[model samples]
Target: MNDINREFVSHDEALARAEAGVAKLAATRNDRWYPKFHIASNGGWINDPNGLCYYRGRWHVYYQLHPYSTQWGSCHWGHVSSDDMITWKREPIAFAPSLEADRDGVFSGSAVTGDDGRLWVFYTGHRWANGVDDADDNLEVQCAAVSDDGVHFEKLGVIIDNPKGFRHFRDPKVWKQDGMWYMVFGMSTADARGEVLLYSSENMRIWHFEQVLFRHPNPGVYMLECPDFFPVTDKDGNEKWVIGFSAMGSKPSGFMNRNANNAGYMIGTWEPGGQFTPETEFRLWDCGHNFYAPQSFNTVAGDTDDNTDGRQIMYGWYSPFVQPIPLDDEGWCGQLTLPREVFLGEDGDIHTVPAAEMAGLREDSTDLGVVEVKSGTETVVAENAEAMEIEMTIDLKNTTADRAGIKVHATPDGSYTYVAYDDQIGGIVLDRQANAFGDRGYRVAPLTADELAADQLTLRIYVDRGSVEVYVNDGHQTMSSYSYAADGPRAVKLVAESGDLTVASLTLHNLKSIGLE
Candidate 1:
């Protein structure tokens, strides 16, 4: 069910192959966080973040690649790696469905490094035999594979295929703590309530089923995709290990199902012997239009010398609904948001920020001192500003404008990265039309209801060599985009059409990471 990409395939053949890869369904148009090597196309489906672990001096990311059609098929775990999280190198197929139970496709899974320093993958076994199926039993059961070198993996065969009750349970996150291996997976009951289950093992195999960590109330009945459990400690002495789940329910959006296959978090204290707060009440990590399938790296970030003294950093596939922009003409679709450091806030709430290492990616910085924009005003960035950082405010109360926004990371071809508050359009729009990241074309993410009515909007737009992230009103809403405009005349612009809004302050600084400091 797999074929090698001929090194010397003709242009037409390569185009066809690329298009064939395009046929594979893609979902969760990831925020503009991915580096250049990662690419995806129009909607179909995308499951877990694959090959997600630090191995042998580098970080690896494998995704359920359905390169033939956007519709979920024989999912081959596509591979890519990076040393600094900046420059990435795409490798060959990491894992293809080579078993009967998982024949329909490799499905989605997480990558883990065992105590032996070998990378072990704990994924679901779906499809009957022929890599395709449509039955209750054909869906999911856990299976695993091992890899010494991140690229080549040896399927250890069925590790544990759907043990005991519950018709559907999949997407396992494995980790070793206190001398025992543990796996947390998303599950569903016969009544359709979504649940997160726990399993433990002395070694990598022979596991005992634990209790359901948490489950959905009702509307989110179908199934939860990826489940992660880890500790989140902030600057103070507060420590809370969080258990999270994501639902991909067939239910529509409403009080019942705000996000189809949505992602949420729950804070709890870990009990003895691989058990957790089983009666935990789940809450949201963020109330945004997109955010789902969040996974954590096993590597303890910050001063790796003491793994015990690190924070649980997270990376989620921000799943945005397809609207306001078309994906076909763009050629590529979704991109992941930058890795983030997740921790507990002093208020006992969760807090997240772009990974500290990403700050090193800043290039040039600029500051425009207190440029005021009434209700309806537009402005362009000055020259010599390729990469930039901006702090601007729009006065929504002063004027009756339908929309107002600031644009940066612009190209001479008229394509630019924009972060605007559009009352007429509703929501904050991170428009990257002409400069579609990875040729995926323009993407517009509307702000949540509360976001649109913030009264005033504060925007921070960061432009790297090929990526841009827009954070509004102190992380109220964030839309990240990935694109390569190394040659484009990068600048910033502001547009406040239909309103007499005034700007509080507009400061741009050259990227500190690019020696412009």
Candidate 2:
């Protein structure tokens, strides 16, 4: 399957090849590190979610798939579809590296529904013609494929080549606006700074070069990989654009430092002439350790509503840059974050919460109603639930505790993942060193005074087999990280570290496995 000259003459030929690759996944189904509620590869490596969209009547999600092994190589588009974003059905491979143009790999891209109800995917076609050289040495081009029934795809061939003088260009994110389709590709200048190029297509075939969307002012060690642009409006109905990209090289200052590569977004306005005038600096988009290359999709189907108030849901790769996954030996290496709903505030601030569909996984319930804890005390709210969802409101206004919040995956041997709010520092601290598989550390995000009240610290936490995701105050802020807990009974605890703490309300729901089903 790794042979570059392998060719699939028809759709059936490609589907057969995909079936062979997925057949080996059953042996690793019982691995301890495999995620219970996330989308992961059947038997290979998956990274950088591609072509995420709602097509026909179901939600389709595509990811960078390396089918032959648990390591990176020539990639294809692995397909998964769901009625709701929570539970998914693994479809056959959507796009394979079978054509001569994309013989090496079919890289990251986005999906769009056409005017005539057809589905089109614009992806980066890559080939390893030369050995690893500078970014220009790799032959990268933007290619297109179309599907009539949202399953079988016909390669429409390369739509846009490397028009920029620099040779590094790929990852075409396409969206329709004002009767024309617009695309933005991730690229870098000759000096190696990250950049994005824009193009417009009157029809799906011919494309016209627009302009460079944005470039770094300083040419340090930086090359942007994935570029995503979409519009968001706050509660006040003021609209703005969110420009996002995955950055590599030296980490940008003020962003999260858990990983060297940071994925971020810029809040700004897209001018009439295609210039992005920023109102705020580039900010960390997801306050998590293993989140990157997030692609947002419009929920409406083709030629339907204008998508003015649709949900801004995004899915991201849940793996760090160079860290090896615990399940690599079992022949799979990556998983996707749970779908998150992004919210833009009136003042141009951004936050993300779990998608509403995740509620469907709740099965049984535990109610720890209105508990109170004194200083230096902790209480177990729920126990013996490996996969569960917990929600509570901490009265930060009435409490004088230096730190008070929830602890998850707590074991009898004094090991747990800690998520606490420190009023002394006015920030949330996510400490996972006790249970993390790799170089674990504490990650923090600021909690502003405006977000705190005597009885208003809303917290939502989702804990699965191997990961924990926290959403604060309906996504006013979020902290997501991965941890590998031991095999034993687990307890969820709420502690008041310094002073008195009051829980206005608390509820826990045992969640069924979204993948095992």
Candidate 3:
């Protein structure tokens, strides 16, 4: 095949070239910072979880990929499948820039099992005008593709053209409700207001525009990308609708929305042909440095093991955009956060916990039961701390310490990443400043005075080769980030800043790597 990097290539040729590129890179690549238990690209670059669905007795996750290099370029769809969401098997490059509509890129989209026993994918087809790759000089249209075997797909051409009064339009998320198909697209008004446009389709091909479902109240939110609308049952068994989107150029407040882009959701109500009425304000999904463009998956009817429990699972891209990732030099970049089971809480907030399937990854367990520290840090686990799961509970009602929590991925030198509860901030903080190769900053998940007075702060943390995911207080709050630490003895430490602190219980489990290498 001719070089696919040339100005033009056929669809088949693009897929062949991508396979050859992955083969070439796998022969001579060795990277230490790659994730052990996350869904990452085999080579090149990946971002934005797309086309998430359960089909043919397995879970499928498609993502935005650029297989030619470790930097962003013309996008393709990378594929992976798993019986459980934890152990993944890489598939072939699913979609390339094949047709005129998507000649430049096959952007982000969603998937569903059609009524005819086929998997249907709806996505944005992006093309550059006159070979200029500027934002204002491009074409974006909604398109669809179908797969009979759940592997290979055939394009069905453009489904929705670019509408007027919108400068930026992309990331189509489709679903079925009330025996009819509905789709939501993230768009920006000509005057720079972020909006989500709703549409209805009868056959999942022809779509008619409905009203704007939800609009950003703030003028600073320039664009909303990858909008997902779905319903989740609260603790009281009442179904509530949720609308999630990634906001670009969003105004920063406190430690939230401090990145170049952030993912958030709103709880609201919506009908088939009416606008969304939000009952709560916008809330951030994960307060971390490297999270964006999260998508959710609920099993459709006639699928094997139909998810009748109303469980909604989500995965977010665990890396930020336009930043210098340390792993980019190793011929691959990016990972997806662990699959999280999301639900509505009694307090009317969206709550996410690591899915129950993650427990299958635990191996040798070490119980460091009930360790206490006074006015300083103490070593909890002296070694074998690089990849493990930690479960701990701190007695907040009985402790008088100003700050106390656990630190992981630490070296003998004064370098470590920590998750601590600070009395001054009245929140839990995840700090990665001391040992990070890039992207250094901390995130705070605020807590109320009533919560602190209730007596305990429970934490479940997962530390991988170059990343960490922290779930606090039974998923009341979560923080995830990438931290490339210096080489030394991997140790775990517990800290108490000013006074005595008591730990009710603590246990550490050495986790098994999925062996992506």
Clashing pairs in 3: none
**lDDT (tens digit, per residue) of candidate 3 on 1-517:** 0222233557788899887876666565555767788888888788999999888877889999988887888899999988776677888899998787788899999999998989999999887866667655667788889997667998777888887724578999988878889899998888898999999988897799888888899998978999999988777787789999999888788877877888999998877777788998888898878888999977653375744345688999986553567776777888899889888877668889998889988988988788888787575664747678899898887777888888888877777888888888888889987874777778898876666777888889998878889888878788888877667767888888887778889999888776565
Task: Score every model by TM-score.
Answer: 0.73, 0.92, 0.95
Q: Which candidate tops lDDT?
A: 3
- The alpha-carbon RMSD values of the candidates against the true structure, listed in the order shown, are 7.5, 3.2, 3.0
What TM-score, to 2 decimals, does candidate 1 have? 0.73
Please write out the lDDT profile of model 2 over residues 49-118, one tens digit for every residue: 9988887667889999887777777788888888666678888788877666576788999999987679
Instruction: Give the residue spans of candidate 1 off by over 4 A.
Output: 1-47, 128-137, 164-167, 234-236, 250-258, 273-283, 286-290, 301-309, 318-325, 328-331, 382-404, 407-458, 462-469, 472-492, 495-517
**lDDT tens string, model 1, 279-387?**
3455655443445677876465211433223545566664545343233223333445566666665545565666666656555545555565555556675653555
Model 2 / residue 229 / CA error / Å: 0.9
Q: lDDT ranking from best to worst?
A: 3, 2, 1
lDDT of 1: 0.60
Clashes of 3: 0
88, model 3: CA deviation in Å? Answer: 1.4
The predicted structure with the larger TM-score, 1 or 2, is: 2
Note the Cα lDDT for every prediction shown.
0.60, 0.77, 0.83
Q: In angstroms, how far off is 104's CA in candidate 1?
A: 1.4
